[model samples]
Target: MSDQVVPAVINLDVPGPVISRHLYGHFAEHLGRCIYGGFYVGEDSEIPNEGGIRLDVVEALRALDIPNLRWPGGCFADEYHWMDGIGPKQDRPSMVNTHWGNVEENNHFGTHEFMALCELLGAEPYISGNVGSGTVREMSDWVEYLTRDGDSPMVRLRKQNGREEPWKIRFWGLGNEAWGCGGNMSAQQYAAEARRFGTYCRDHGGNKLYRIAAGANSADYAWTETLMKQLGELGCAYRPQPFMQALSFHYYTIPGTWQDKGDATVFDTDDYYRTLAKAAYVDELITGHANVMDCYDPGKHVGLVLDEWGTWWNVEPGTNPGFLYQQNTLRDALVASLHFDIFHRHADRLVMANIAQTVNVLQAMILTDPDTKALVLTPTYHVFEMNKGHQDAASLRVDLPAGVPARETLATVSLSASRKDGKVLVSLSNLDAGAPADVELDLRGGALSGVRARILTAGNLQDHNTPGAPDTIAPRAHDQVTATANGLRVHLPAHSFITVEGRLG
Candidate 1:
């Protein structure tokens, strides 16, 4: 750790475009307990709910102001048929979920249920089309059924399915992971198919289509380069109309060995630092991929949608290993804050990012207990709630003075700030959790008088919240920040995230 604090002045005068809300996107897959027991509990649970969807969980997500949620499946999206889960719940057919544990999936939660859920959270629904197994017509019709207002065949079916109004879905993923789970196809093959399918998925609602093409697996820059080259410059005659608005990429951080991944709750200092280092790669991926996109289209029409990202590890003992379920700890919270800062810093190219599954699944926000009817909020949830201000706000760069890295595992400290409604909010995260860092915030040449801070930290990096002890690791008010002449001086704890709120009064 370096004791030398280099004095650098940052002119906060330069304010980037208000942050896009989709930058806080979430994901809900039809895997594990995510759908059946997590979000939906059938119309028969003792817990208060609408159509079996937990009310407590809904309120929790609504408080977080969830911007957008990717629904249906990771791989299941390609195989899911929207018509199956609409109208009468009993009449809906049942299918086996092959990608996730081969569990039986009843048609209870179809298009109507999902749209209704999104409505409850006031979130935008980003549906992934089934380009791998389904035909072009099926894909196009699904779009019509959800977004069409006129009396077309699909629109008529929507009326029959008990919904009179269209959903007005904006973000449409052309396919899931096309290179693998989304039906393996060559770059040229997928690009050609994308051109055909995306063309017919007309925007009946007049909403600009955000058709996202399946991106490469982690670190596969070639896949991104090939897709961008094939799609070519946007607005070209040869290019498909409104050609893919964004490219979807997926990445997960696994501490310890990649094969024998360590447990989320049980980790040592080494594991904690290693995970942060691995998680920081997200920024590198964004920069590398954006560089490739610049070669083809410099206008920055296309967005880099980190559609899937989070920490992955072995499921809790006695739980289904195939379910991809794991515990959320303070370590995961730190991991999420770092990613959120990274996303804000590069908000220009990184338009949206979804943190894997939502509830009771991998890196979830809310966890439920079918046996005890208990609902617990994970540490990651608190981070989301604290940082919600970044949504749709102007981004300002923060200068992180050099200090001893939080841990040996992390190398650099990064920061981002934003202003909304006369309030200047700054988010700071120390990558190295082992060493304390002093940050002198240069408010872009502005004066700071009265300021308050709220911080999220834990007793230990490995600490987590369980049903028995849910509030073990959560956010609390901190007075460590002092009022200075130029700006505020913040002493960030090792391996912690803090948000300082300053009013321009």
Candidate 2:
């Protein structure tokens, strides 16, 4: 293993824009209990719910200020025909959810219910269109039903179904997992179909519809390159015909081996470091994919939307493996912080990101068990809430002393600083999970008085939260600080993430 040397002076004078709401976007799939018991639990259930939605889950998400939510499926979206999910719940058609457990989907939580949930969370809805098993007309009609304000057939159907006013849904996924669940088409085939579907996905002049084409799996730069070139050529020929606003990418970090993914919270130190390294791939993926986009369109017409991302591992023992119900731990929090830092640094190219599922699913923010107090906040959830300062805040440049921490693995350190009100908030995370890092801050021109720190770490690398011991590893205030003459010299713990806030006097 060889170590790559990086520059010590990282003078980031270029102030980047605050991250978008969709950066913290979440996913709601028809997979297993993610929908049935995870989010919607019929109104008749004894549990407290509003219109079948778990009230506790809603409240937890609200606490995190969940920005946007993607619905319907991972593979489920591609095969999903929107019509089956609309109309009166009783009259709505039933379909076999072949992609997830082969269970019968009783078309109860359809367009209206989803939009209602989004309204409840105050999150923007990002809907994935069916491009694999459904027709182009199906995709168009769904869009019309959601965005159209006129008296079209879909709009009339909307009125007949109850929702008279059109919901403001702007993000539209062209397809999902096209290489696999989404028809498993070659790049050329998916590109052609994407164009056809995107053409019919009209703006309706309501809200600016950001049409996102399904991107490649991890390291599949060819998929990105081909799509960008094809889309760019089409745009050149037809000024703005069926334009793409973003390209969606999906990546999950699993340790040990791909076949046998280790538990999220029961991993060794090596697995812990490896997991962080795997999560850091987002930076490389963003850069490589962006380079491809730059080749076709230097102006960056299409944004890189990390629609599906987070840690994935074997399901908790004794639980249904298909449910994807796993523990959330301090390791997850570190992963979240590291990825959030990467997204902020690349805010120019990276527009939106969703951490897999929101609640009761893979890498969820909140988990529940019929309101009997099984709700546990994963470490990932805490990092999101902690880093909200970077939301829509300007990105700052910070210089650090560079030294090799581990052999073979690539290492880098940087901090994104944002000023809100009269306080300067800085989020710092070390990508290296195996080695501790020493950093010196060069805040000469800036004021850094009255600085305090809050850190989220644990005694062991595999420490996690359980329903029995929920608050065992939550973040706590670590306000010990020393204001040096030159700048602040902080010792960062290995595999830990910290956020420091200072009021500029």
Candidate 3:
């Protein structure tokens, strides 16, 4: 260790924004084994399942306290029709998932199944409606069917199907990607369409609708501004509208351009650093979009929804190119940690952020073998489990002395802290591939009580879990934590993400 001393100070007395539980959310689409074989193994399969969902997967997700789950699609949502998947399993309709794989999608899992899965996992369902291919009446009926408790046609159909009670669904997306897949509409057109769709998104009982407008692609701040401007006009005293609660934004970090996403499992240090460099730009994206929203919504009346955010790597060789399946590595864990810290920093406007396709899909938390009972948690999964306590926790002020920023990337040390109840949770990530970091904590107005830490890291930067050896990467007790006279001291390992939790006495 060098004689130089550098400390990262945290002031407990000075608090930041409160971290919303919805920030720790997930997403699932009707692509690949994400549904058919990934999480749902069918009730008749030899694999153990509860209500046709993998029990092992259920337990793993529940353990993370997964708050919200966006379902049906990434691009698939706009093409999804709710009615086709509700009746008898044998009588259900089938359609080709043209957006994803050109494979036939048997309507076995629909509204009922998704809500049931959310129930099993204790996650709120953030359903995306079909705006591109569906009419306003269709979305109106879908919401009414899932939320109505009164005498209505949708309610009658719900009873006829098997579910008697209506499920409480607060979050709804009017469309997916209106700029492209959903429909090649400009922001003004989509915003007007959002108003029409928002009109019939009626609250059935106490379930208030938080209808979201389809948001921008990466760095399309003009789209955000345009949508917010039109939405501001529509939601006026002369023309009061429904709860257009939030505007959605989709961004995926790619090492190279979309044409060449680079390899997932096989990547050199330069590619790894570039991938992280792209991840570092998430803060810029959020700040840029938030700044636009701030102008239209000075009171912050309309929040920003980072509906989809994660990494998109080149598909594994010999796999279906359409199905976004990739391997998770220590680098992925680092990228995810950086995104979490960024979202936490902007928790005020950032209502909910779901990592793309929760299982067997791009940057999935859990991976399942195609024809086996094997279920393994990725390093990203472990990071989520470790940081679950920060949900709904008020952010603690974090002050990092501005240092020499990485020339190719942003800050090397990514950190965020939150206090819930009497507990303080500090998550730190040292992204340097070769250098370990020694950072001191200056927790003002509080003495060190007890700090327990867990870390997710690996020997090789490319290290990941294989079905044969799932424990190759997992959380272990951190031995580098000790109390300091000023606050606390944490010696962080390189390419690692650690969450140190302590009782704020």
Q: Please name the candidate that would achieve the greatest TM-score relative to the true structure.
A: 3
In candidate 2, which residue ranges exceed 4 Å CA deviation? Answer: 1-14, 233-241, 370-373, 410-414, 420-422, 430-438
TM-score of each: 0.95, 0.92, 0.97
lDDT of 2 by residue, 1-505 (tens): 2322322232234455656656878899988678888789888977788899888888888877888899887899987888888877889889988766678889899888898889888888889988888888888888888888978898998999888888888889999989988998999999899888888888886567889999999889999987877665633332224557778888888765777889866667667777877877788988998887776666665689999998898888877666677778777877888788778777777889988888778888888764464677878888887787667766666554445354346453546676656667777765555555655666644566788888777776678777788877777887544566655666567666788887666
For each candidate in the order shown, give its overall lDDT on alpha carbons: 0.82, 0.77, 0.86
| Best candidate (score: lDDT) | 3
Q: Using alpha carbons, what is the TM-score of model 3?
A: 0.97
* lDDT of residue 86 for candidate 3: 94
lDDT of 3 at 94: 94
- Candidates in descending lDDT order: 3, 1, 2
Q: Arrange candidates by TM-score, highest first: which order?
A: 3, 1, 2
TM-score of 2: 0.92
For candidate 3, what's the RMSD? Answer: 1.9
What are the per-model C-alpha RMSD values against the true structure? 2.2, 3.3, 1.9
Candidate 3 lDDT, 391-430, residue by residue in tens: 9999876778767235355677878998888889999988
Which runs in model 1 stand beyond 4 Å of their true positions?
Answer: 1-8, 233-241, 401-409
